[model samples]
Target: MPVEWVIDQIKAPDQSGAFSYASGAAPFCEIRLWPNRSLPARGFVFFIAATAVMLALPLIAVLGSPVWWGLLPFILGTLALTWFLLRKSYRDGAMEERLKLWSDRIEVTRIEPNQPETSWSANPYWLRLALHPNAGPVENYITLRGEDREIELGAFLSPDERTDLYNALESRLIAVQARK
Candidate 1:
């Protein structure tokens, strides 16, 4: 799970011993979400090195022959292409979603590589969180609707994670609404 609760203060009390629920502009909860990455930087380096070694193993037999020279360029090219494609995949996966829940409002911001950033915000009172199990592009799709606008949330998350996120969001929203 790549979801991180950056700031969780939904139940924090103020100096007066009251829930800080709509007392200020500060958000009660803030969360950041990103797609799970299996290959980290260290793993990537190791993988590339291992690939180079494996790809070079066949060259040992032809080391003193002209065949090695002929195969060297092709092997290097293949390795280069593999590295390039993996790097591109890493770049394409560079995206993040941030959700901030304030006393009176909820806001979501999406940051994607090589694309314009997008944001949405609305009053929590009028907001609704929806989870679609089978009718969406992905299973357990989650969306937030408010202020005459609707936005998808955690679309990159797995089905189970999306369901968990929906549950968490629903409960948190309910708690905030209760204070209103």
Candidate 2:
């Protein structure tokens, strides 16, 4: 399907209240200026730490034996896996930039390797945004829901951005509901 463009221009609060400009031109989908929350650096650090531990296992094991030869395959395998994971994460991040909004519909477009773009839509009136808090020491995911469908956005934004997006979404939902 053709991609629609949506732009959300967040304006400072006036005498009335904080208002957002949501506009869509032909062929352009809807855009919402969501608070941009980036993924935490700690998560990356943890991942790297975990990866380092795994990568060190074979080397440590080989230290006392002739099994150092095994390090070659392990090194190569870990490199490949790490590359794949990082690439997948980057692609997922890129796909989250486009969104669609309608009277009773919402759609999201994202990119993947073989599949560059993916789209999903739902009933806008009944749709809800769900914020799932991360357990332990990780950041949470902000999910938009409609019936059984859920889309996670703002995964790579900073904390401040996440709060802004959350507030913006709440305000938008209120505005949309009040119009009806």
Candidate 3:
């Protein structure tokens, strides 16, 4: 998960000590969520090296043979296809979602590789977060219900991450309610 950053806004310094939910978070918001990524810096380097080595073994054995020439194009094509697919997947996976929960309103920002960034908002009082562990196209499906429409969140996250996000959201909402 390539989650970018989080911003936490507190209600007030004095109020925080007296109340467990002192984060005037309800009347206002201070929550952010980001998507998870599977690959890391080291993994990418290892992956490319392994791919190259695996693809070169047979070619090396046939060096100087006519067969090597015959197989060259096919081997090169396979490597090219692999590289293209991995790059495409990485691009497609470059997606992120941010949720901001405030006392009066809820806002979400979604950023994708090719599409323009989008945002949505709803009343905090009317905001509802739902998680469908098995009912949607993806596992651990999660969606946010607002006044007029419902928006999905964490779709780019893994199952476990989605579940964790749900828990965190649930807690924030509860704290906001407690403050109100």
- The C-alpha lDDT values of all candidates are 0.87, 0.56, 0.71
Q: Poorest 10 consecutive residues of model 2 by lDDT? A: 12-21
Residue pairs in candidate 1 whose N, alpha carbon or C atoms collide under 3 angstroms: none
Off by over 4 Å in 3: 1-5, 9-35
If the candidates were sorted by their TM-score against the true structure, best first, what order would they fall in? 1, 3, 2
In the range 1-180, model 1's lDDT, one tens digit per residue, is 989999877563344214343565557789999988999999999999999999999999999999999999999999999999999989988999999987577889999999999999999879989999998999998989999998999999999999999998888888777776
lDDT of 3 at 108: 87
**Alpha-carbon deviation at 100 in model 1, angstroms:** 0.6
The candidate, 2 or 3, that scores higher on TM-score is 3
CA shift of 44, model 2, Å? 20
Across residues 26-92, which tens digit of lDDT does each residue of candidate 3 receive? 3334444555446665887788779878988999888999999999898788878877877788788
The clash count of every prediction, one per candidate, is: 0, 19, 11
Name the regions of candidate 2 deviating beyond 4 angstroms.
1-6, 9-29, 32-94, 135-138
lDDT of 3 at 33: 52
> Which candidate number maximizes TM-score?
1
Task: Please identify model 1 stretches exceeding 4 Å from their true place.
Answer: 10-24
RMSD of 2: 8.9
Give each model a TM-score: 0.90, 0.48, 0.80
